[model samples]
Target chain A: SQQGEEDPQALSIQEGENATMNCSYKTSINNLQWYRQNSGRGLVHLILIRSNEREKHSGRLRVTLDTSKKSSSLLITASRAADTASYFCTPGGSGAGSYQLTFGKGTKLSVIP
Target chain B: DVKVTQSSRYLVKRTGEKVFLECVQDMDHENMFWYRQDPGLGLRLIYFSYDVKMKEKGDIPEGYSVSREKKERFSLILESASTNQTSMYLCASRLAAYNEQFFGPGTRLTVL
Candidate 1:
């Protein structure tokens, strides 16, 4: 089942600017994860925010989750040209062994240098 | 490094040919997943296995089947490749209790 849905299907941002992406899910989840995918390739794990945690940060990345709203946001600071990739947010929980992550349609981000 | 390696990065086959995409993980994880990606549609799960010799169908598993004869390897098979099967296929794996799946570089299959 496709549970997560991200907003702003595509985004273009200048290098050094901050990029923000939002994701909304259908049902309750134990955690929400963010991933990055280069063109025609696999996804790289970025960050994961748990249901009990409202906010978390990793280096220049900040993630906030609101269980009430069933939404989450990922903020990237100081974006670079290499940041050009597709960003996907996945909803987790109620799946097999906690490994089933229902992914969203993803937001394609193009960072201009 | 937890590495997930796919057998082929790109493949091309006839419409009626049987196609196989293999994925191997060196981490010996207990879970493996195969997904197909289409433009504007994101990633859709085709199958997943949590143990050897066991497989489960995913959201879109109509023309696909899977094999997990070993814990470190999983294979996705297309009984009869169709043009619609032309897409990027990704393989992922993670520990049984972990949701942080590690993905392979993907196989771009083209059916003509």
Candidate 2:
């Protein structure tokens, strides 16, 4: 079974519009991270929110994590055509040296210009 | 900048033939992972190595095996190439916790 599952499998919005994608996981994770993939390439890390942090911000990207609900959300404010990509959420363990990051199916966002 | 390099960006192989996908990271990171990306399934981990000669099976490791002969390099091997095995193979290296992962461009494999 997949540890994380993203909601709203596909989303579309015009350029400059805000986009939000949600991910739900079932586990006691030390932290959750967001990543973006353009086309068929490998994913690029976006933001990471630890279990102790509720919300985090980086540039136009904002991420919120609710440990009680085991859910996380990534918000891309004022999206651009280049923001059109597949977004994924991943959970990592607290172990001193945990290597694997369990990934979700991902949400595909289309920013129409 | 840390660079994770994949030997091939695109590859084509015949069914029943053996295939190998190579990934190398220059950061000297101890953790290396291999994943396969599909349209709806996103990225599924195939294998991971935390240290040289160490391997761990991921969720969908059925037809795939991995080898980690050195700290900075990891290899994913397909014992018998099958059409179903065709996918976008990704390699990533991370330090610890939920830290940012440096990813390679990825190898798009097609088994016909």
lDDT of 2 by residue, A1-113 (tens): 23578889999999999999999988778888889988655588998888999999999999999999999999999999999898988876766434678787789899999
Compute the lDDT of residue A30 as modeled in candidate 1: 77
Tell me the lDDT of model 1 at A65.
Answer: 97
- Among residues 3 or more apart in sequence or in different chains, the pairs in candidate 2 whose N, CA or C atoms overlap within 3 Å are none
For B13-42, candidate 2 gives per-residue lDDT tens digits of 999999999999998888889999888777
How much is the lDDT of residue B50 in candidate 2? 78
Q: Which parts of model 2 are misplaced by more than 4 Å?
A: none
In candidate 1 chain A, where is summed lDDT lowest over 10 consecutive residues?
A: A93-102
Q: Give the CA lDDT, 0 to 100, for residue B63 in model 1.
A: 98
- The residue-by-residue lDDT of candidate 1 on B53-91, one tens digit each, is 988888899999999999999999999999999999999
* Every candidate's chain B TM-score: 0.98, 0.96
On the 0 to 100 scale, the lDDT of residue A27 in model 2 is 73
Q: What fraction of the true interface does each of the listed models get right, in terms of native contacts kept?
A: 0.74, 0.76
Classified by CAPRI criteria, candidate 1 counts as medium
For model 1, what is the error of residue B39's alpha carbon versus the real structure, in angstroms, after optimal superposition? 0.7
